[model samples]
Target: MPQETTDEPGVTRPRITPLDIVRTLVLVVALATLGLWGFGSWTMPWNIVIGIGAPVVVLLVWALFLSPRPVLHVHPFLRALVELLIYVGVTLAWWSMGSAWAGIAFAVVAVTSGLLAGRRALT
Candidate 1:
């Protein structure tokens, strides 16, 4: 997706980069994992609640603080911190479901992508 950058007085849309694609993929994977974790790890009724709720919560948090245009404009460091926390939560969720290697691998990719994206955001 093209993101609007305020390089000039007018709104200029910038071409999406590879990092942007990866970031979007990471987010999709994270939401899917959270949904699966909720359903797979819980009982019937609670599973229904959490399976839907987990992804919704993550989406809200991301929209508020981590999106290209966030509702809450925080410091870049704070934004990164929130992003890291979400990744950590997903990693731990994977580990809890007996997928230690998957969690670690996701952590590696997610953190690397986040760092690169954060660096670009800072610049």
Candidate 2:
């Protein structure tokens, strides 16, 4: 897909690089794991609901707000905010599940990938 850059740094990279694709895939995994965390965090009946709902909600939010040219077509700042929310949400979800190391590791990777991706956009 063709790409257009915004005034922000790293917004101008090619439509998708290998790193970008991998980062995106990893984010999806975080979302999925977050769903599992949600499921396990709750009681029986609620766990079932959370397991099914959490990932679906995250996926929809990503598609609607974070994805490029999403259906909502939000402003760049708003898009970035939504993306941050997702990233933080997943990170916290992991932490809340008593996986501090996993949370920290994912946060480091997510932040690094985000910075690198943004830097790539700037070039």
Candidate of highest TM-score:
1
Tens-digit lDDT track of model 2 for 1-108? 988955786666555678878678867887788778878899989998888888889889878976655789866667667777777888888889889888888878
All candidates' TM-scores?
0.89, 0.76
Q: How many steric clashes does model 1 contain?
A: 0
In model 2, the worst 10-residue window by lDDT is 113-122
Query: Which 10 residues in a row give candidate 1 its minimum summed lDDT?
Result: 5-14
Mark the regions of model 2 whose C-alpha exceeds 4 Å error after superposition: 1-16, 119-123
- How much lDDT does candidate 2 score? 0.78
Clash pairs (backbone) in predicted model 1 = none
Q: Candidate 2: how many backbone clashes?
A: 4
lDDT of 2 at 81: 70
Model 1 error, position 47 (Å): 0.4
In the range 1-123, model 1's lDDT, one tens digit per residue, is 998855766866779999999999999999999999999999999998999999999999999999988999998889999999999999999999999999999999999999999878778
